[model samples]
Target: MARELLPGQSPELLKALHILTRDGALNADSLRKLKQVNHLVRLLAPAIEDVLARFGDPVLVDCGAGKSYLGFVLHELFLRPAGKGSLHAVEARPELVAAAEALAARLGADRMRFERAAIDAAAPPARVHLVTALHACDTATDDALALAVRHGADHVAVVPCCQAEVARQLGEAAAPAPLLAPLFEHPWHRREFGSHLTNVVRALALRASGYAVTVTELAGWEHSLKNELILGRKVRASDRAAEDRLLGLCAAAGIRPKIVRLLFPAGAPAP
Candidate 1:
């Protein structure tokens, strides 16, 4: 008997994403992975629905889209029914882009487009309602945040990965004796601290850029190391305190990020 997914469920997408076997059975680990993906979609679904309710249709840009799993699943479940929105998957790897394009074509997902470009270099489209990045590595996640801000996107969702740059930089600097010694004694401690700093700075940056931010644990920390989702929505205008804290965090870490300049321009007041 042929396997079939319930209508509106995304079994085909899971197979296309290589998250499931051909026999339609999810293994112990695959189940965890699928759960995470499902939970992420669920978490973002309300926001998407809310936006659709307020504004007609929304354009979503998924950065570091990899094989476009999130894009495909989202389009299958959310954008398809609405029939008014589009999805753009931004990825730097040509092979992954090609694979995503093929899967999208096979799935008849006409509303989606796969672009081969890093988020930093991606050209701005007219309007984007939502921006998402799942496990985008290190500072690349920052680049995605900057892109979302540049486009004036209404919602920004990010899961950061492999935060090494800030940690390495922080290691070179001196922390206070007790805290500094223990933190620097082990490489892993330094990495963890860097990860923490990265997220904190990112949150502050988003707040400064006028977006209300929420940091939450993604459903699958055991399945994947990068399991924190940072969700932000534009609430009001730029916040001075957020910008000031962002600059202060950058200075303290000694890792100067270009996103700081982009998010908080020269004329902006200090936070």
Candidate 2:
């Protein structure tokens, strides 16, 4: 148990997070959590830097921010040093929000704010430059994506978790395509296929909303099961072809109409 420090990371902040004990020691669980936060920061830093370069004081929103770990790390390593950015962490749990607020106060993270609201209901007080949701459960990831689309954020990064919507749809109805029937035959297969399909649809939805999207692993499977990371950068125009493909996929997978409506609203061109 030694003081394993990440360059540019605040040791006191880590101590406050309980990632490191007061004696500067880390156990297995804390070390794993620290690694996870480090991985997230590494993945998101370049995009944040780009925004900072373009806009002197950009705003970042974290949806479904449980403990606001990502927001805090970003504030300490990126925002605080730049002295030109804001971090808003939105969470449904009031106690967690209070905890994050207290931590931010202790760490002197004046630029950070915590909201006790769900992803869909939370309103950012300012224009958002970037939107992020790490391991947002079930349809909450969709809420984050919709929030990005609605607010016209410059960038979005989300890692979706526990996607049961598609699986439930597939289980309720007969497979729309015979080829996919085998894939949905078993409960495990249904769950796995549903998760992959959900992300694909999400990427397509972002593309349709005028964002270039990239989907990749947030970390190794050994580190986390919810590893899929969807990164999006706003572009000039929406891709109609992507929208058509998304609709087609939904039809093939027998996804519910309500979900489709959530991704593609009325004004969005239909296939």
State each model's CA lDDT, in order: 0.79, 0.83
State how far residue 257 of model 2 sits from its true place (Å): 7.2
Indicate the TM-score of model 1.
0.88
Give, for candidate 1, the lowest lDDT window spanning 10 residues.
1-10
Model 2 misplacement above 4 A: 1-4, 257-259, 267-271
Pairs that collide in candidate 2 are: none
User: What are the per-residue Cα lDDT tens digits for candidate 1 across 113-190?
Assistant: 888998899864777889999888777898899988888889999999888766776676544335345654578877
Best by lDDT: 2
The residue-level lDDT of candidate 1 at 190 comes to: 76
Alpha-carbon TM-score of each model against the true structure: 0.88, 0.92
lDDT of 2 by residue, 223-244 (tens): 5688888999999568888888
